[model samples]
Target: MSNGKVYLIPNVIADGTQEQVIPAHVLSALSGIKHFLAEDVRTARRYFSSLKLFPSIEALQFEILNKDTDPNTLHSLLAPVFEGNDIGIISEAGCPGIADPGSLAVKFAHDHGIRVMPLVGPSSLLLALMGSGLNGQRFAFHGYLPIDKHEFSKVVRELEKESRKLNQTQIFIETPYRTDATLAALVQVLQGGTLLSVSSDLTSANEFILTSTVAKWKSQPRKLGKVPAVFSLLST
Candidate 1:
């Protein structure tokens, strides 16, 4: 039997409109796919409905691939594709395979010799880094920091040191509800001259992306509130 292809579908960063963040070709590709592996089934359904590209949501098959999903179940998820049915992988937000569980499915497709295609869309991390004025050529993406205050501080300092030593950019994100707390911790821990970038509510009307030194930020700090955001750092 002929194997099918796997498409990596990116999701919107914010809740405004789909057309603003998703590319036209991605929507066109989505219109033809009937199977999907998503980080959140409900969110995937909502995204599909927003596009109006698919024939019917009820007719599509969706498999959940969140943090709680077991690695053992990945084969079963790709069974349809092996049977000649093209499948799509969608995340809760942004592109899959970056701080998302959808990477597991992509890896499986690669191991099985299945073709995988990635579509263009909004990515808060990349957007933040692009506006950071930092070393985009050599950057690292550390999804989320340690939740413990002490551990988080240690990690923050280490990333700062590495950034300063190698002139490499360090990027990470925090849960929406804890954005303020994370920002406070970062501002207090990183060196005064360290450059920081914050991108929030990307692709939405209320979007904001700012880059400034830690000292300047302390003089006039802005609350991140509960909006989803991406943070990057570069030492000077």
Candidate 2:
């Protein structure tokens, strides 16, 4: 029997109108997918309802797949798909499998010979990089930095050095609560001429994306209370 395809769906990054961020094609895919592996089921329910993609939220099946999810259970998540049932994998925000636990399910699908389809949607990191005017040709996403101050500082310096030496854009994100501290660390740890880009509340009405040198950032620091943000670095 042929296996069903797995759709790696994308979600909106911030609290905003759905039509503004989610593509029509993504919604169409969601309309036909009744089973999902999501980072947060509650959020996924809310997202689907907000987008009006499905007829009945209560009828859909959802499985939680987060950082704490056991890798051993990933294969079982695809059992339905192997039974000729198409399934959707959703992230808490942005593209599934990028920085989310959805990667586990996607990997399992690949190993088991199931087809995988990625739908178009807003990715805060890529959106931030595009707006930041950073090196788009060559770049890397470091996910999250170490929370320990010393280690974080050391890694920040290394990323700066790589950006300087390779002309590669360095991208990373922090928890909303740690946004300000992360921003401060970037300015303090990077060289004066290193370019830093901070994009916050991307795709929302309050979206902000700025790129400046470490020296200028230090001179005119901006407050980024508690909000979703992406940070990028490029050394000139």
Candidate 3:
């Protein structure tokens, strides 16, 4: 029997913005998938229900696939695919496998000779880079910065130095609650002329995106209010 394909599905970055951010083709592809691996089953159910794609979400089978999931158990979690049943992977937010634990499953599929198909969807990293007016051709995404103030400060300076030397954009994210602290650290550690871009609550009604120098950001500070945000920096 032929092995079923593994579909990498993307979830909305913000709540209630599926229609605005998700394309019709992605929904069309999702309609055919019944088995899923999600970081949070409850969130996945609620998201799918909001799309009104399935009459009964209960009819679908969902398996846990979060950061805590053991790699040794991946083979069993993906058993349905081996049985010729296509399985979709859904992350808590954004595209699956991009800074998400879903990458583990993708890697397993590749190693085991299973077909993997990635559907088009919203990716906060790419969106932030596109809007940052920075060097998209030469950019690096560091998933998350250190939460420790001292370590965060050190990393910020190092990244700024690297950005200046390579002329590359440095992109990273922070926990919603730490947004203000992260912004303050960046402003304080980076050079006055360094360009910093912050994209918060992307694709939402309250979406806010700004690109300015560290000096300008310090002069006119704005509160990000504990929302998901992506930060990008470029040093000249």
The 0-to-1 C-alpha lDDT of every candidate, in the order given, reads 0.89, 0.89, 0.94
lDDT of 1 by residue, 1-236 (tens): 89989999999888856877788999889887899999778988998898887678899999988889888998898888989989999989999988888888888888889999999988888888887788989999998999999999999999999998999999999899999999888999998899998988887888888899999989998897999989999996
Which candidate, 1 or 3, has the higher lDDT? 3
Task: Report lDDT (Cα) of residue 131, candidate 1.
Answer: 77
TM-score of each: 0.97, 0.97, 0.98
Judged by lDDT against the true structure, how good is candidate 1? Answer: 0.89
What is the full ranking by TM-score, best candidate first?
3, 1, 2
Candidate 1 vs candidate 3, TM-score winner: 3
Off by over 4 Å in 3: none
TM-score of 1: 0.97
Worst 10 residues of 2 by lDDT: 15-24
Number of backbone-clashing residue pairs for each candidate, in the order shown: 0, 0, 0
- Per-residue lDDT of 202 in model 3: 88
Report the C-alpha displacement of residue 41, candidate 1, in angstroms: 1.1
Q: Give the candidate number with the greatest lDDT.
A: 3
Q: Write the per-residue lDDT of candidate 3 for residues 88-134, one digit (tens) a residue.
A: 99999999999999999999999999999998899999989988899
Q: lDDT order of candidates, best first?
A: 3, 2, 1
